[model samples]
Target: MKLPIHPIMEQSFAVIDREIGEHKFTSGEYAIVQRVIHTTADFEFAQLIKFSPGVIETAIAALQNKTPIITDVGMVRQGIANLVAQTFNNPIIVAVEEAPVALPGKTRTETGLLSCWRKFPEAIFVFGNAPTALLAFCEVLKNTSVKPAFAIGAPVGFISVVESKHALAKTSIPQIRVDGRKGGSPVAAAILNALIVLSC
Candidate 1:
């Protein structure tokens, strides 16, 4: 059966265009912003979402080249739209969880990220749930020669979400993410999906 939600979602873009005018975002930037707002219904992201100068261009190039994508959570992996996979043919890597986390005093997210850090240096890292994952990725990036194509650090929660995103923004790596605790799996997925649409 056809889902009625599709048309309603289509209409929301018109509403968004009307609601937000004369914005500073470039075309690709605006697309990502609009998609994030559509996914989360959060208007405040107009001010909160941040990106580097060439983030959209760099990310699009990376996607087109089939850059590997790594996620902190399964939700983010699952949320990646089919169009992105089919178009980019990218590998989606989730943080490890096959066995009990071995790192001392580390959350599963942290240890899992640690395990996969070496395997993926130039990946597009998406952290949609665990702040520790974002922090760990940043740390790993710093300690190694591996650089990411784009880092989407949108982990949600009060603990380290704000700080982690801030750190990611300051890094030399190109990044696309939001500040505060208003991000999640859907937001990360939305950013990736928007990038894919723009690239295609």
Candidate 2:
């Protein structure tokens, strides 16, 4: 079922469509781009977002299958919770909150993300606020058989943001990433929300 949209949001989408004329996005890709733009009101996301080959279909299938959803932070979980509940109702695990404390050599999010990986290696992993978590995840992908159903690497910041995205790109996993330091919880949530809508 299609979710209800407020009139204001409807008008905003119309404006975005009119202004963002002539793009090469496929229908599924454009839906994600439009939602990200709608969430941030920044057209730059249209250029920053990247998708791996056949990722959308794979991600949508994962969602429809009720694959668990794991997020590096609570904000990203909160942003997509309602839609998730309305649709697949997949379990949402917040990485940072799951960790008892920061590990000796890892951030709390990273530690928690690794912990989640051990149990739900096939979960949909989303990193919206911690590049360290994304980096850790990529490291796991490199060294192990933990292939996520879908990965979203959109952590926003200057420190390791670019490096994290680059690391994710090197992986063969199905994924969506925001290049550079242009992504955050909102963008990450928007991308997942778009995928949820497509799955419906």
Candidate 3:
């Protein structure tokens, strides 16, 4: 089947390539990033053309049922949180490398990294961290009963991005990603936005 590339995906690929070209990343890493973008875009296109509204409605409904949305990065999680709140009334939980604390004159404290997982029994977890952290998350999922429909840990950096993709390669879950050296909120947000759009 011929796959259509979303405009956003194309743009993301270009962005990643341009960024990688100027960075110290290895050629293999660059190729891997390209592969990830191609695969993710192709998959999303297939869903949009094949399932169309069904998939989107299901995801929306899942959120309406108060399914937990888990994420590692604060910024990306913030975007996901907003999208979830806007699209559904589900509870959202963010998993971070550190936990937040509420202490006088203290900006933040890591209450506990793993503690966040307790908020949701079975929720979709989105991660954007280094290879080690990504693998750790995946391992935890493997050792547990959490089954995710859509998940991603594409870090968008040299070793970390490569590591994130590698860790996910072992799983069969659908994922969204962008190619670049440094993945930030924009990349994560754009991915979620695309999912929402295509899901419709």
Instruction: Highest lDDT: give the candidate number.
Output: 2
Cα lDDT tens digits for candidate 3, 62-106: 545666666666776666665555555455565553455533432
What's each prediction's clash count?
0, 0, 4
Candidate 1 runs further than 4 Å off: 1-6, 96-102
Candidate number with the higher TM-score (2 or 3): 2
Candidate 3 accuracy as lDDT: 0.50
Candidate 2 lDDT over 66-148, as tens digits, reads 99999999999999999999999999999999898999999999999999999899999998999999999999888887578
Error of 3 at 76 (Å): 1.1
Alpha-carbon runs more than 4 Å astray in model 3: 1-61, 97-113, 129-131, 178-182
Clashes of 3: 4
Winner on TM-score (1 vs 2): 2
lDDT (10s digit) by residue, model 1, range 150-184: 88888888998899888787789999888888899
C-alpha lDDT of residue 78 in model 1: 86
The runs of at least 3 residues in candidate 2 whose Cα sits more than 4 Å from the true structure, single-residue gaps closed, are none
Error of 1 at 34 (Å): 0.5
**What local lDDT does model 1 show for residue 156?**
86
What Cα-based lDDT does every candidate model obtain? 0.83, 0.95, 0.50
Q: Which ten residues in a row are the worst by lDDT in model 1?
A: 1-10
Superposed Cα RMSD, model 3: 10.2
What residue pairs clash in candidate 3, if any at all? Answer: 99-110, 99-111, 156-181, 157-181
